[model samples]
Target: MSEPTPQTPGTARDDRLAGKVAIVTGGGQGVGRGISLGLAESGAAVLLVGRTLHKLESVAEEIRAAGGTAECLAVDIITDGAPEAIIAAAVERLGGVDILVNNANMAMPLPLSDYPDDAFRTAFEGGPRVTFSLMKLARPELAKRGGGTIINLVTSAAVRWDAANYGVYSAVKEAIRALTRAAAYEWAAEGTRALNVAPHAHSPGLDWWMENNPEEAAAFVAGIPAGRVGDPLVDVGRPVAWLCSAEASYLSGATIPLDGGQSRWG
Candidate 1:
């Protein structure tokens, strides 16, 4: 199969979310970084919230360099009052929140039987707990904006049959999926849409796998009917950008798989 086309800088730029303010957790690296860039490129002032100040600054700088607005909020979202602080920062720094992207999560790869209590706690707090907190805190602001979009970054593993060692990971992700859908229904009257995106894109984790296990990585890539991993910015990010826009107003409480046909093919 031929390679997926590479996207050049500013090639697909548009003002789809212009004048809007978006809060993206873990916006410093991986898929979060790409989503931040995509949102900025589409004309939203992004508040990049994460633990690493430098990484957040770096992504924020890239947005500024591209003539997009962004701000860095370095904090551990798992901490108490962090959600409140994040919402406050977005309002103070970038105006009210019109979009909230719950994209940060940490789940160790372990079988359900072997998963320790500490590891499980870490995963639960970081994923579903934080996501729930942020969504609850941002609801009033999102509603105040007349309408808003909440994009929760879930995992395709939640739906895959052969979870194997991904048992604990999938459990937390599934919780996020449930929270998103529940919010979608509960907030329907308020014009706030909540949805999930399960993305299979190139990231540090995938790079580590490819470098350490080339054969396995190759077979994994081959399994994807698209013949390659999805691009973080173009494949995953662009669609997310569109999803947060008025064009997707009709969409809510749905999990969109950005896996290059891997979900269906499997």
Candidate 2:
């Protein structure tokens, strides 16, 4: 595996993840992008996977510009072949995987009564199923390194269920939360740790909501005790990076709230 590039003058390098290899799905944008950059900054070779080739390329370029190593793969995670392909690519290019961030999610805001059956299936496919597939596929690679960390991006809505049109989304995310806990126990002997991170950040999806419904957006921000939405990288990504490091090796099966105290469940 390639080592992380040396940091430039006046730049500090946190080598907690030195020589580690990570795969971040949906890494082309929003929370995934933040986590991808954060892991790279911490000294991990990252494979950024997303459906949009251009977006993945852009994020990869940003990582390269920062003197960090990153490669982009554009693939739809909902496909049957995607998880295996992703793991194969990471192992081929970066050597082995030490971290897996399942951040790719598909959500459609609609009440249960009105939600289409196909949309509901797609939501589950994009959410928990994709996460499960990736984790299983990456298991051997992680075990090869003695052990590794898996972070699945969940949401506060999974617990709160307060949002009017998010029933399907919440259900799917909650399923992933359960899977994360189960994986933590089942994969422990193999040296893999599984955890969930529920974040409330200013993501691109939220940005779109803010643009379409200003009143709801204002109310959402006002509800947070932090008095503002969290930055994707500053608030969410750093914590995720820490979770993947040796300092947090003892942690597993926990759903950490990265939502500025907005989530009722920790």
Can you write out model 1's per-residue Cα lDDT over 82-123, one digit (the tens) per residue?
999999999998889999999898887788899999989999
Scanning candidate 2 in windows of ten residues, the lowest lDDT window is: 1-10
Candidate 2 runs further than 4 Å off: 1-12, 161-163
Worst 10 residues of 1 by lDDT: 3-12
Candidate 1, residue 87: CA error in Å?
Answer: 0.4
Cα displacement (Å) at residue 218, model 2: 1.8
Candidate 2 local lDDT, 1-266, one digit each (tens): 11123222222159899899999999998889888888887889999999999999998888788788998899998887999999999999999999999999887778889998888889999988888888888898999999999999888886674778878888888899999999999999988999999887767778888889988877777777776776777777777889999899899999999887777984
Candidate 1 shows a clash count of 0
The best candidate in terms of TM-score: 1
Best by lDDT: 1
Relative to the true structure, how large is the alpha-carbon lDDT of every model?
0.90, 0.86
The runs of at least 3 residues in candidate 1 whose Cα sits more than 4 Å from the true structure, single-residue gaps closed, are 1-5
What lDDT does candidate 1 reach at residue 155? 85
